[model samples]
Target: NLRVHLLEVEESVDRVFSDDSTKKAVNLLYMYPNGVNTVSSDIQGLTESSTNLGVVTTLENSIEYDSTARSS
Candidate 1:
């Protein structure tokens, strides 16, 4: 269930980022919890500019499960 949900979220994010208008408007940093790792925008000088702009976009999922396989 969680895996499926994460996949759906990833797909949605990918769709949004794939748009040309959105890509030009913002810098993005995407992270996944299970297998797929980090995905970042291809903006030039992102590190320097992002730090100067004091803007950050982070997508994180923290799911903790107990030994009984139930969410905690």
Candidate 2:
């Protein structure tokens, strides 16, 4: 039950960030697809500062990850 709730919250955060008018928040928690967790935001102004550049994979799953960056 707790995991499901957290997943919903993660989705909500994704939606909020996708909005163009939304201001950057101080924190973000992503529940990776395989179950691992991550914290991130584009506030640092990296060259690739967007959700596409900030995803982390869940180590327990075998799904293919497209990003070339190493998964944390």
Each prediction's total of clashing residue pairs, residues at least 3 apart in sequence or on different chains, is 0, 0
Q: Tens digit of lDDT per residue, candidate 2, span 1-72? A: 123233334333322233432222212223323332343464343333222323434343222233333333
Q: Alpha-carbon error at 30 in model 1, in Å? A: 14
Off by over 4 Å in 1: 1-18, 27-72
Off by over 4 Å in 2: 1-30, 33-48, 53-61, 68-72
Clashing pairs in model 2, backbone N/Cα/C closer than 3 A: none
lDDT of each: 0.30, 0.31
Instruction: Tell me the deviation in Å of residue 22 in model 1.
Output: 0.1
Cα RMSD of all models vs. native, in order, equals: 17.4, 16.0
The true-versus-predicted C-alpha distance at residue 33 of model 2, in Å, is 9.8
Question: So what's the TM-score on candidate 1?
Answer: 0.14
10 residues in a row with least lDDT, candidate 2: 20-29
